[model samples]
Target: MKRRALAVTLPLLLMALALLGANALITPARADEADAPALAAVAQAGANTAEWTVEQMDFTSRYPQGFVFTLRATSSGGEIVSARVEWMHRPHTRAKEPISVRRATGEIDPNTGLITATWEPTQSTAVPPWVGVYYRWRLRDAAGNEFVTDEGYAEYADTSRPWQRTETDEVIVFANGLSDEMGDLVAAAMDAQRQKYLDGWGQALPYRPRVILFGDMETWLEWQIGHQDTTGLGIVRVGVTSDEWGGTVQVIYGTEEELAYGTVLHEIEHLYQREFLAGRTVFTPGWFIEGDASFYQLDDVHRVATDYVADLVRRGDLPVLLQGEGPVTFGRNALHGYYLGYKFFEYLDRQWGIAIHRQIMDLLVQNMPFTEAIETATGQSVLELERAWREWLGAPGVVPTLIPTWTPLPFLASPTPMQFGSGK
Candidate 1:
């Protein structure tokens, strides 16, 4: 797999092409259309082609969005006249519209010389996200002769694409097209999480979520294993690195149309929760972890959360609402824990306002009693909160008398450490 940096600055290189327009200084006048002698010069120029070979073929350059790239080429025998570079994306667009590359073409000499063109990228709503830098350049001589080639193409990945980075202390995402905004949105979520850490609501995660995107899954996976450390989960799976607070996330492909933004937000926050509370037992179950992530992200995650809730409501499994951390494990047909946990967080946030986490965070930080903090944050204790939740779930008689228990495993002998890229 080709690995890509989760660099924040890189965006897709957009090049819109136009047909040979200005600077076709010498097209034989159509009035002279049937005049062989009149068109002979252009014919001859077309015959002895400048053979525009791209020296930059597979020459990777870091192209941030909206920058100009000057295309280069050498003419044969110093025998050519002029050269121009035209751009095209065949996968998109048709004859009706052409992509315009501003200040698109440059000049060589009237003799066998080099041709150069500049690409000033502009955003396009029509182009779908894709990997590979692909641009077909058309070259011509002063006599109106021309040649075209796609050797100028390049493929880029979005920084928000999961597992595509690890270059910093903080997670970063580089992306283009529709979802480019996801990186910062997730950053905001991470900020919320950090507040949880600061306020003592949860154990501090050692690392930040750095996201990078590719046009799709292939490149996403390609960049993923590039930095996969063998410490925890193996290839295609995120692992714990020997280093501090670090892990990876693979952003599966989707859009706002098919799934709510909550799906991505939920998974990313789960990654943080897992890594931060690594090897620590939580009195709360995984549902709370997932639910909290979803709940906190409701501005974007509401529909999906509702979907889960609705599914349970339809199934008549609503009895599990206050089932007391129902599932020790997650997603094995359990709802009250994960889904309800989200509702719990949502409930707390709504009734108490979002800032309550700040106070809860403080409780966790100073090691204030969890129940006491719940009482302090809202005049209700943990049991009172559960009772209210039961009333809301229509399970007025339900009660949760159990607290989750986690016993740390005894230290086992360490495994052999191996170097990256050294696996057999």
Candidate 2:
């Protein structure tokens, strides 16, 4: 599947079509309005300082390895004494301080005023292709005057492959070795849930999120440069979402329908949780996190989860939630938690409309205890909520008894693979 020569031609054709329709392209200048003030400040700072005139500035994308930033400037303030480059991922929320910013000192050519800085990917800092980067230069002259350039935006792209991209108000879809129709499906899915996202979270993501789909394993494995190989451990990782990258990186699996309606949407919801809900915090249970993400999936995906969980309810085998590890994320029946968790959110939506979800999340963000937040949102105790949710699932309105046991020894943690199909 990875060796198709058509993959090369298809992306070129799609790129040509995209160029004919300029609106289809994503413009980095359209960063969130919340960032306007900070950007304006940078522009103002650059305007007020006439000491340094930027002769040339450029950024080069060297995917799977690193990128380079170069600047040539002539400073009237005196010979440039120091130079540095700082960059951060885009779509960052302004509600808190930006913590993703990274800095590196540049090697300066004193006579030519040429400054160069390169960022090499490390085990801890590697990011997938298409991750948006906002960078700027800082310079200090011998006269002690300091100047900061306006921010520049660029994507970490792999030029080795012909990639097709599409953008909407909600998402940016990048694909290689996939049909162009897949981009439309993903964009439509995001459009379908845009209102729900706004209603539940009170706002869109501060930045346009990206979905990078790899149609073949070889392409997918290319950018995972420093990561540990888990194929020998029997783990097949289909996809992963990261707040640091501000998007989802997925290896195509199943039909494009499944990828569009379930996998892509499910992973995107994780991005929302990270942006608005603190992202898998200790106070947030795995069931709630994964289930909330599941709620956004459409078509047969939700049906599968509903049916599977309904069977568990009928068999009197519903796992106890909000206790212990709060529905296991791994091990036997690992997906049960995801299915059951979807049921819980489904129950909430059916019982009180989607507003209840926002209420619960609002409380959670306020540092309210999990049980207390749910109780406050639903006006019911944890036990009562559980019983109600079970009853809603066609079970009797009774809380299942839990047998107490001694704490088990801790074990090393492993990565959780994002599985699709079945229940998405």
Candidate 3:
């Protein structure tokens, strides 16, 4: 998907104009009666003799809410049968239809030989802040001829937030309800080790991924679509790169400094995974995805995992890593799999170097079976790999739980409250 960082600084006058445009539609001049010579000149300069021609097209306001627009068209057959304005989010690669396209309504100006129309987009849930708009004109003539203007672009940016945006060479951070210091810190953190990520992952971001951090749960929930619950869901989704889907890291507020920083890296890692496995149709396990994310965030995650998994193994609570045959990222002991999966990658890295990660990801991109990929990467059978990992962690060959037998207790009612002074 094509992406660009939009840095629109909306001033007070611009805000007033945007608001006014949203409320009213104004046609500056009669398309047919006014500027006829200019229209003719445009047609003469860039007209296809056989099709309807667009003499002029541009936006009156580029505000997300109620941006105003005007377009002028001319026809060769003296019959401009129909005209319409079509627009979708800019830099889009996944939308199947225009976000909105309404018929342009205005009288043809006889003097100017042009058809002009105005569109005033209103402020509503449909139009939000920082939305990019790509628009064009479509015209039809009586001879069944059609004309489409070259694509035009704008943004439905909210000057209200006056968002504090920071950027490094690799990533950009957009923050609302966050202090400039905090925002800059986050950006600096990303910049400090941007190369480490790009080098380790063996891929670069398809677009500059944005880290949008909301200040608190209230603001995050209010901004969210569908009023979804954001109770403890730190990171929401790395959505499609469009205004409609919002191509950014959409997540809730982070209260703790370390946790928040780690969350940012974790979500960023998710973006790398998305680009790496873009077109594959196979079901890559979640354990690998989340585990790899954890590993990326902290290189010493295997040490942490070793301690945790070792405790589990001593308690006979260590679950089988590759034998569950279900999702390992979430469940009663979900984190066990995450850290354990990190150790799995850690083992491979130690034996084969970080190159194994790229090799396994390549296998995944090819839709290869997960076990086969691991075995291929490690040069060990799946079972053998599991046994070796267990050995590396000093975990016993078998983990048999010791369920304590339950002895029934006799039911006893509390003795009636003893009289204040009579405990017999």
Best-fitting candidate, scored by lDDT: 2
Q: Write model 1 residue lDDT over 23-142, tens digit each, in one string.
A: 222222222234344234433444544554556422233333322235455445343354444332212211222222212445453454444443322332112223223344445545
Query: Model 3, stretches more than 4 Å misplaced?
Result: 1-128, 131-142, 147-149, 225-247, 250-256, 298-307, 324-327, 397-424
lDDT (CA) per prediction:
0.41, 0.72, 0.53
Tell me the spans in candidate 2 whose CA falls farther than 4 Å from its real position: 1-50, 279-282, 401-424
Worst 10 residues of 3 by lDDT: 415-424
Q: Work out the TM-score per prediction.
A: 0.41, 0.83, 0.63
lDDT score of residue 395 within candidate 3: 80
Indicate the residue-level lDDT of 69 in model 2: 89
Clashes of each: 42, 0, 7
Q: What ordering of candidates by TM-score runs from best to worst?
A: 2, 3, 1
Question: What tens-digit string does per-residue lDDT give for candidate 3 at 1-424?
Answer: 1211222222442453354332111211223233345334433433336656566776654433245556677667667776655454433332221122223444355576565555444222333345455655556667765555555666545565567777676666667776667667767666655765766667666455555665655554443445444436763432222223223434343443532355666666666665555444444566777777666653345567778777877886666665433225654777765777677767777877778788887787676766687778778876677777777777865533335465223233222111110000
- What would the per-residue lDDT of candidate 2 be over residues 56-77, giving only the tens digit for each residue? 8888999988788899876787
lDDT ranking of the models: 2, 3, 1
- The residue-level lDDT of candidate 2 at 336 comes to 81
